[model samples]
Target: MSSPRFAVAQLDEITPTPCPCGQARRAFKEPWNTLATVHLTDIHADSKAHYHQKMTEIYIVLEGEGHLEADGQIIPLKPMTTVMIRPGCVHRAVGKLKIINVPMPPFDPADEFEV
Candidate 1:
């Protein structure tokens, strides 16, 4: 048997970075893990609509109420609301919200696109 290949991340301890959604703390961004990447996103009123070329994202709302605009369609968001956004879909969060975003194949800045 081989050693366990895994990692643990403390979301709150990670420094938040500026994102279109306000702020985000991304984890597992290393190339070693190509499976997925997790992000703690703080959504603000100024969040902008954007898309990913080759990444799929799963968002789990954690706090606050809001609406997710995807491909021009708005969907209500609340605590425990989960949304799966595929590649090429333009989406953004309206209102103040905190969500957990998981991106498949990890997150690559090069894959993010603004429409």
Candidate 2:
């Protein structure tokens, strides 16, 4: 057997998992790729404020309008809006939204901290 150099993930085929946000379909979560990971997130009105100690996340809004609360600052969000969140920045999405999240250095559950 040979190791594959590339991987593919179908967004719709991926199961949505519960997170601080509403639900998320994550791709490239395997240990083979530690540089980055991608997620399709459906944000809920009650998304909790949280931060990552090691990962930096880039969020690109895909649907609906909302606001991104970062470090107590409210930033409006809309379709195509993009936000880059650094480590330790307390943040959460308010209102219903769909976004594509790209996490650098990958995402680790242990690094997630509630604010």
Best prediction by TM-score:
2
Global lDDT scores for all candidate models: 0.90, 0.91
Model 1: per-residue Cα lDDT over 1-115, one tens digit each: 4433988999988999998889999998776787998999998785878999899999999999989999999999999999999999999889899999999989888888877
What would the TM-scores of all predictions be?
Answer: 0.93, 0.94
Q: Mind sharing the TM-score for model 1?
A: 0.93
Per-residue lDDT tens digits for candidate 2, residues 1-115, read: 5546898999878999988988999999887786888999999776989999899999999999989999989999999999999998999999999999999988788988988
CA error at residue 42 for candidate 1, angstroms: 0.7
Q: Tell me how many clashing residue pairs each candidate has.
A: 0, 0
Model 2 worst lDDT run, 10 consecutive residues: 1-10
Write down the RMSD of all candidates, one decimal each: 2.1, 1.4
